[model samples]
Target: MDVSKEAKESLLVLDKQDGNKVKAVSGIDDAGKLKTVPPRKEHEQDFLKIDKHSNILENFFSNFMRQVKDPTHFEFFKIKTDDVEKVAPVIETMATQKDTASQEMLNEYRVEPSDYHKEQQGYKPIDESRIDWDNLKQFGITREGLEKSNSLEPMLNYQKSPGLHRISATFDNVKVDTDARLAFRETEDGRIALAVHGVRKQPELDRPYFGNNFSAEDKHNLLTTGNLGRVLDMKLPNQEKPIPVFLSVDKLTNELVSVRADKIRIPNEIKGVTLDENQKAELRSGKAVLLDGMTAKSGKEFSAEVQVNADKRGIEFKFPENQRQTQRQENGSEFKIPQKLGGVELSDKQQNSLKDGGTIYIEGLTDRKGQQYNAYVKVNDKEQKLDFYRWNPDKAKEITPDNKSKTQVEVNSNGKTNEATKEQKEPLKQGQTQADEPQQQQNKPRGMKM
Candidate 1:
């Protein structure tokens, strides 16, 4: 098993004697030597143990992943099964494939060759008398090493077991089960895909039928935990769409436990935004992160450079107010929508739109200091689609009293302003419809309601 360079760097090396306690960290030096550092008294333990004969790079990942508990750097979600009915079919396919794949692989990739014709056709023996043993010795090629080589001793020379065998892989302390935590990976298309971890069984089976020798506690854990395998692609019972979440393993108990998926969580998990380390640094410099995959009220997807919201305050997904719905063929390519904003609590209208993969345009959004603007929001939309029209701010019309010919207005009793009215301004261009006017909104009066 080849571990990725990132995973290798994230792991720490340990001695098995430390038990659950991480004693020291080890890594491969540039010279291909094992580098070890004793545990600092104040440092946290993260590495797993390694046996004396094991390769440092290969074994480090195997140990560290199994022993390390509750990863701090990663986000987790306490995901419960939403719709088991929607997930069962997927599980059945996975289970069937698991069995089918095992047999196919055993036949396709046998450790031993299928046919022994080459071995039966033995190679000509080396002429010992003509061979210069002293000269070979000078080059460190000893007769003992040569005799042990596979060329001199083939399986055809001896009677051995016939037929193919399937070799099951096992990891010490790592238990395989039907249930697993899913890790999300960002795809080239800007979508997030689920990468499962901590389990080896198919989604259909609640328990692993092969590979694992179960203990009493293992059996107990299997029965108690809920499986998310089937629901990875299904929408939550309450949410408008499916979300990717990760599960964490407990170091102390070696069990799957509830954790928050930081990426999708509210304020506490707002850091789950596409803001990586580099993006965070840029955000600190008052730069906006251009994120994608958000849908607008008109079923058009758009992207924007979102400003990083203050920490501790929750972020929001919203669309601007009174946005006209237009089909893609109507020369509407870009949706001037805010993908992520800072706020908490969705209005009833916004929640309803999010429920059905629809979009919401919320007018009169305010910050803590009473500043106002509008926003557009959508739910259950694709992550990274690029074929929509770009929003042209210059073409947007400022909504004012001059653009109020369509709506009837009521005057006050005193002939003074009874209702708040926008400033009267320029008239519409000849033959231009109201729809052709730009749709830019002005900040509402402090106490005015839409």
Candidate 2:
């Protein structure tokens, strides 16, 4: 009749029956005391073991499912199972459920399909025709390519699971310049011993200026002043051989020399002969001279002499009397003139001078006779004989047209005028007598009697 007491007693019996294997289930008893109902011995043992190994078994199953899901894994396994008959239906059902579950999860999370699979599916397949097959054959990718395909499953596995990926690093193509010297050596135990004298970037010259017993001043001048004249005799310690020493201008010049006893010592050669101040000054002052001259028809000739200075700046010309003529011509020719000189006109000279460097000097012109005139000159790249002084406005007007005219109109205040033509005055009418009409009487009909 008291079920709670009965249940408690039963639980106590079960607890005593199972040795450490039974899991105890607790509850409140009839007396309001905490009581546990222990499981059966066999069932307690099985449940306890399951609880202990649940995580391990779950992980193993997950890993196995992941392997089975990969397409590349199926290809690699090459299993002869009847996939269409046995596995297809299960896969279809699983895929449909997975898709529905994925959609539900995505809706709950508000995630996009693109975000889920972008990294795995976005890459485009390489077009084989577009790739340079000859280059691939030359480079060694064909056999290696097949090997990569075979390892696709492992590769995909590594990519999908962050925990399984492995990485490797390597370095190659080590080199050093000719002027540099390695300053450290590796020991057998993989430790490195650094040299007391570090690497230096410089050429080593064997010269007679650096001797073991030379004065410090001589060594300083040899290195700093680049003076190859100084020579010093050095005696080796272990032998009677005398070695000519040369000064070094390198970073590691303070270090000890590592020279062998049998090596031959040679003199340091000088680069080249250098010029002294006097010779250099002479070369600076020597240059070709360019002179310009102008001649007129009066047998008068004028020239400008430009003397180049020693600094190579410019040639300074003494302002000559002939320069005045050039200045006058430049000023006078500011506007085009219609006159002709020699046989050429001012228009021709204006065209020539404007094309050239602004000043045109006429040469070898002493006389101007009628229309025959000649003066030599250069304009731009062309040379011509021009008549410089003949500019006649009347001749220009004849060749072109004299269409330009001036008209005058006079206005007078009074009737009197001087130098007035007939056409300029107002005309008067011909005379007519006043008696031609009959007179009218006052008593008569004034409208009809006249």
Candidate 3:
């Protein structure tokens, strides 16, 4: 009895259960055994081997799950696999068609060698024995000398040392006599000595010590000797004393004299006391005098009998010549006439004319004291009175003699006098001119006569 088919069918069920236990227990069985048990053949062992089957079920299940979860993944895997199979045929055809294609591509991509490496490949090593020691020595590079010196020897050698103080002297282009022959000396310990050569006056010099860098000329100048006498002994100059002078009283006012030594004396006549120089001579000749006690004379007191004629229309004050004194008085006198003493009279026509902006004229008027009086006219109406002088015929005629219309009286907006003339009207045209016709008639034919 053959159990191969049965065994193949039973494997799926066993794998679904304990697959590790089935793997561990599976093996070949003897031929004489019950025919129900199948023998494991060589091909069967290859198919059922656990090593070959390792992770194969896991991969297949993962692929199946991926296909079920993402349809695009399934399609992409299928298309990529098909494209790979198509690409293998294309690569094979290209390989068989050209042998140089691969060689040409490799040659085009290969990096070329560098110039420095190429030159280095042909270079020879330098010879050490041919170097000149003499030239190296000039540069202070000797082997023993360089070894003995410190590493910072050059820096130490070029370092600057401390300096000593020195005195610099300059002289103007004059020479001094040195017959006296002064000598001076100084030491580093601050010691000094001074002497004079060939001086029989005193062989031993008694001068003070001035250390090194001291000159005999400097010592002589500091000692104040010989030609430096006047420069050192000079004194400042003195200021002058102010003088006193005499001045006249008249000159004091002229500003020509400032200081006075004596009391100012004025003469009894005081001739120069005139207001100006041109009157000075006249004053001196006694033609003019300063009248200290002058007084104005008192006016005379005279009385005149005034006659006043007053009525309802007007009033007048008069002094009759017969009543006035004919003889002149010893003292001057004055008489006054009041404006209210005279009253004005207006006729009905005159009043109406004044109210209608008319002007009045008076002639041959006389005043009291038998004197001829100037004539003046005034309007009394309120509106007419304001500009009465402006509309006066005499005043208007004086201003505009050529303008006769201004002299002709006219009524104003205030019922007062006005100088403006009435505007003249323009005359009508002779025939039916455009302006003469009514507006509606203007549209009709001009051929029709008026």
Please list the residue runs of candidate 1 whose C-alpha ends up more than 4 Å from where it truly belongs after superposition: 1-273, 293-301, 309-450
Compute each candidate's TM-score over C-alphas: 0.17, 0.14, 0.11
Tens digit per residue, CA lDDT, model 2, 1-450: 322221211111112222322223233344533233334433322221211111322332233333323322110000012121232233323323447774443232121222112223333333333334344343222424333334223222221110111111122533221111112233587443322233333323433323344355645543543322232345666757665433223222222232221221111110111223343333223222233443322223434433322111222222355464353343222223224433444567566554343434332222211211222332211111222222222233222111110001111111122332222323211111111122212222336342
Give the residue spans of candidate 3 off by over 4 A. 1-344, 364-450
Task: Write the candidate numbers in order of decreasing lDDT.
Answer: 1, 2, 3
The alpha-carbon lDDT assigned to residue 130 of candidate 3 equals 35
Whose TM-score is greatest here? 1
**Predicted structure with the largest lDDT when compared to the true one:** 1
Runs in model 2 lying further than 4 Å from the true structure: 1-195, 198-211, 223-231, 252-450
Global lDDT of each candidate: 0.31, 0.28, 0.25
- Candidate 1, after superposition: displacement of residue 139 in Å? 99
Give a tens-digit lDDT track for model 3, residues 232-252: 111223525332222111110
What lDDT score is found at residue 241 in candidate 2? 65
Please give, for residues 290-323, the per-residue lDDT of candidate 1 as tens digits: 5565433333455544432221111222222322
Report clash pairs, candidate 3.
186-212, 315-343
